[model samples]
Target: MAYVITKLCLNCKDIACTQVCPVDCIYEYKGDDPSIPKEMLLIDPDECIDCNACVPECPWEAIFEESEVPDIFKDDIELNARIVGKERFVPKRNPDDPIPTPEQIAANKEKWGYKP
Candidate 1:
């Protein structure tokens, strides 16, 4: 199983996880959101080697093993896979890149607002 990035990362956009990721599985959307804030970070499960390198690397404590993740956040695993492509794990865009469309922000905001 792979690790997941949960809602705790929203508005925090910390990319420390990305810098520490050896496989570059961790990426931040950099376009609209520069500095790849926690809100923009999404782990590419496809590219992830399940190295656990990013778990401790996260300052916000957002990363967690798939099994260890809470039920509320477990869906993030599928979300990451779908967004990044289930078969091809490489990030569709740079983690430092941001696509701040209202839709993008709204989708993430919905999850962030619930904050389970």
Candidate 2:
């Protein structure tokens, strides 16, 4: 089964998991407007190799194996598939891109009016 990224990633937006993914399956949906707060990222089920490398890399513990996903986060599995299927998913930032620090994440949250 593929891995799914959950709501815990909403404001966290840490790229650690994405950077560790052997396949470029993680994606985000920031919509057409660059000014908008980016939504959570998702794993492309079709592309993911089911490798667990990303699990330990996620600082927020947002990624989960499909079968192991908690009941509360089960919807995220479908969400990932739906977003990818609709071609609304944007590829994650390059692995070489610098990850945002805690201070930067906080500032971004404030700038985007995101509570978490």
lDDT by residue for model 1 (1-116), tens: 77888876777564667667777776655444232333546777777788898887665567888888877777777655543632222233246744355455456546655443
Index of the highest-lDDT prediction: 2
Error of 1 at 52 (Å): 0.9
Runs in model 1 with CA error above 4 Å? 30-38, 85-116
Q: Kindly list the per-residue Cα lDDT of model 2 for residues 23-47, writing each as its tens digit.
A: 7788775556443235678788999
The 0-to-1 C-alpha lDDT of every candidate, in the order given, reads 0.63, 0.70
Stretches of candidate 2 off by over 4 Å are 30-37, 85-116
TM-score of 2: 0.68
Query: For this target, which candidate reaches the highest TM-score against the unseen true structure?
Result: 2
Q: What is the alpha-carbon lDDT for the whole of candidate 1? A: 0.63
Q: Worst 10-residue stretch by lDDT in candidate 1?
A: 85-94
Candidate 2 lDDT at 86 equals: 42
The alpha-carbon lDDT assigned to residue 84 of candidate 1 equals 63
